[model samples]
Target: MPVTDVTTDPENLTMTIVADFAAPVERVWSAYSDPRQLERFWGPPGWPATFTAWDHTVGGRAYYSLTGPRGERSSGSWEFLSIDAPHSFEVLDSFVDDEGKPLEGFAPMRMKLSFTPTAEGTRMIGESHFDSVEALNQVVAMGVIEGTKMAMAQLDAVLQDLREFAQGKGTQVELLDDTHVRITRLVEGPRELVWRAYNEEELMRQWMLGPEGWEMTECVIATEPGQQHRTSWAPVGDTPGEPFGFEGEVLLVDAPRRAVTTERMQGTDGPETLNDLNLYEEDGATLITVLIEYPDKETRDMILATGMAEGMEASYTRLEHEVLAPAERS
Candidate 1:
């Protein structure tokens, strides 16, 4: 319903769609920047999308699968070519296989999306450039225009759901699937500061401790892929609790934005989990999202039963009051 116009230029091998929304540019932009919000409306009505991987920085790639009502799936990948926050981003979009390899004989398209302020709200322009007329005609024949219109129509509900996506909601958890759990917290700080608080030993020692009466004893931060990072915590003074620690190998790092790591108990051979941390800033507050993939449903249930969400909330509170507050003051 937000779509105002849709056009296809066969001579130029391009298709453009224009939509207007009654939401601020930032609000509209966040819906696309965050994978959680994106998946809610990325696919058409009957085809819900699941983003298996999302790396939003330039040169990064995102892989997603759209599952049809009949259990069929269509996979796709986007290679980010350019990104200018709250303004524009370009990506090489492709039809991909399950493993994210582009399908043979299907040429990829270059799509650029832009967001701009309007008197009423925000206007979004999405333009796709195909390699040849055949390619452009091919996609149009496959219901691309109608599918896109249906997908964008769903964005209206997401933008209006301020309570669910707004800041200061504390740490919240969502069970994405049998093995994937997503935890999100909106912190009162900039993205850079939050990213630093997670990577710097001094800053982490100040707030990474969960609950009161505990102190961090060991902190080894990882700065690059494949590096090992470890942290340990012990109860201080008369506080009653045994010492514990976590160790992880960083699988990917895009500073100030995203990091992916493998985490497990320090000395235990227990199953490990994949943690994908993403940070996005809007209106001076940063949204911290961590998507955790457990080895199985049993492991997921066991971990959540350990008061992990409550503990994370405590840590995030400390992070704001102790780490970011001081940094902001300075």
Candidate 2:
């Protein structure tokens, strides 16, 4: 199938599966975030899964049943430990009885899903951790590996549906002046919702990711003037290096309208930038505009040479697919 590798660690009792998708990371993440989309690929070819309950928040639980061709049914449930949308999440997965209670004979395992952007598309890593090697081998004997591969292969079709839902021209970037750049986009959602997405720390993390295989490690936001706003990001996997961070102070705060801030790159000798963000209602959509003014032309050109605009485009695409599209649907 689309899976590139599947491995089991004997000492740790962990099974890891790696697969690549030919769609953006946001589009691929939709398969897991959207229940209807998840049902299309969460089971093997002959066994289709149907969810009875799906609660995605921390401590939330999900219940589903898989029906075989011959009418046989198997069910299970998941208890969410953590959820980081468009990035990764962890859950305690277990077999369940018809009454939705965990089966005493089965061993529960912790499962984690990580979505990382790639040049081609998204790289998804699925890992299952068991308490003992015997428990891991038991599930392997139950054909878990083959079933997982088949289920993941169905993601292509789900991605096609997501692409259709997320259709658009994409965001645009303009150099306003030698020391300033403006990024704009028409997001499909309510003005208030669009405003909230940018200001809220949880929502910002979903779409503000800068590049492939990188994620925000910390996010702190205060919407009041004179308050502090801080954030940091780093490579998703085991990459050696310190995280890149930004420290800023809110200069202006206008609810559902505009905001102004001054930000500086952490651990670098760089000039502080004045960031002006404004939002407007355009037709039935929200048009967002961001202006970043650097201290000098030399600093602006240097950042541009690093391909910041192209990376911003990728991030805004995620805004369209993950935040705006889902908010509109709901």
Candidate 3:
């Protein structure tokens, strides 16, 4: 058990938990920053969590749900107030509904999490402040303390397998649901640089091309919400492939961290997909996660069958070798 102590104060209307881990502060922080590793231990035992949206930035929000053995779901959300990488973050935590809205009559709690280096490894401190004594007691009666211990106990196994979450794992895909798919790739670069590579036309042209025989013919970026963006690619020289393109309207844009867009074939009126892009950096490497929501399961299956993951891996390899490495050298 990593949890050393759990305490509650009626006078202060706060609850605190202290846990220690046998890993560096950065590694421990990465577990929380990346939704994949986070979901592994965020819920207790049979109640595994699934993060549908994660925006790891100040003023951002994260939405997740825990599924019970009987298929029942409990939803929650966190509104980030402040963040200092590898150190501390503060959020307003609330019990939400299926649609992610806070449940009526349940007040949100202000929670602060801090990570520090210890002689053995890292010590994590979590403090949750409630609005009233009833609020604190209510959650305690709901088994918050016991549930938390069970959750943190699972973290040790996650921290031990470091390589699985680190860089050099090529582009990976996760079938999140019938219509949702998540694609992740860790590139050796800073978050800002990687974000720019996706937004800046000149930089994108250098590494966004998939495989060896293609070239980007046109690139249009959307800098803000509601704006449209388009990108087209064509095979070069003797390469045998037809030209193709994608066009989308930007739904949300939190520069250098997250972006949400609706994408579809350039000239097709068939269907559209929502693409939610997120970037998080740990130890100088950026983890790029794109959660795509297709119109249906058929569309999701059709797209994955087209070797999309392979093409994405090829592009990510080029991104690190051609764009990020050169930027680091310069």
Candidate 4:
């Protein structure tokens, strides 16, 4: 429900929030109380979180830290007021110091988190009460609601992904530019076969998913920053429509190291992503780097939410086994 009311007494302040997760109470509760599952969506945008302590008892405490841009951390804690397994709980929570001491000037809070089972999924109610009306007013101005939801959203998506993975569907990925993700493997094949996996038509066709309808009809590869790669992308198998073509320019490429950079052009569309593909050779193996860039925070978040990087890794894993491995064995 929309924040129905905003009121404060000299000694108290409260705010309420509601969200529906597309899962059962057991799933939702596990996501909430399980420390591993809790950290995924636990902070405001641009901040990552880690749960340090969680003891779900009447007097027990839960603690977590939100790490900011430069690795600085703001820690918060929750003292359990009540906990009813898989249903509802209440806690006295606050932002505190490393030693678990209350910040000298900040007021602590009593928050209620309730999970109600619904036909569609689980309905969550998170209500927070501050120590004073003045404190509540300050938090409202500071956007506690948004912050809570951000944290909750992360939890929701993380659980949904775990559910998917358990069912053999897929994993979820969150892309952060500053975080370097290196995926490497030794390919027994020669550089030429590796290069073909990247640039050759017939060889590409062997593994390019075109027969099943997922390959690009044409790629204009100029092999340099100023050059262009003219290409046309087709839909995957069973897709009902003609192919859509695109032109992409080679933004950078180092043939010796087997890397290529391209700027997507007309007929090409993607998730506002600036993507770079690099291949490094050592002892005849290619270390590939799929570098992706975003213009700003909004798009970074969009790309992150899509889990494209994770999907890329999965598909690449399949390619390495089915495509490259065979060529080497041949």
- As for model 2, its CA RMSD to the true structure in angstroms is 22.3
What Cα-based lDDT does every candidate model obtain? 0.87, 0.80, 0.87, 0.60
After superposition, candidate 1 runs with Cα above 4 Å error:
1-93, 96-164
Candidate 4 — number of clashing residue pairs?
8
For model 4 the local lDDT of residue 316 reads 56
Q: Which should have the higher lDDT, number 2 or number 3? A: 3
In candidate 3, list every pair of residues with a backbone clash: none
State the TM-score for model 2. Answer: 0.49
- TM-score-wise, the better of 3 and 4 is 3
My TM-score estimates for the predictions, one after another, are 0.60, 0.49, 0.60, 0.52
Across 32-111, the per-residue lDDT of candidate 1 in tens digits comes to 89988898679865466789999999999999998653346899999999999999999999999998899998999999
Model 4 Cα lDDT, one tens digit per residue, 199-253: 7655554444433435667754555566655656677768755665445555444
Give me the candidate number with maximum TM-score: 1
Q: For residues 1-330, could you state the per-residue lDDT of candidate 3 as single tens digits?
A: 899999999998899999999999999999988998998789875466889999999999999998653346899999999999989999999999999988987889999999999999999999999999988988998898989997897687578643357556688887756987878888888999999999899899988888889999999998888899999999999999899999988877667866778889989985888887867676688878787888999999999998889989999999999899999999
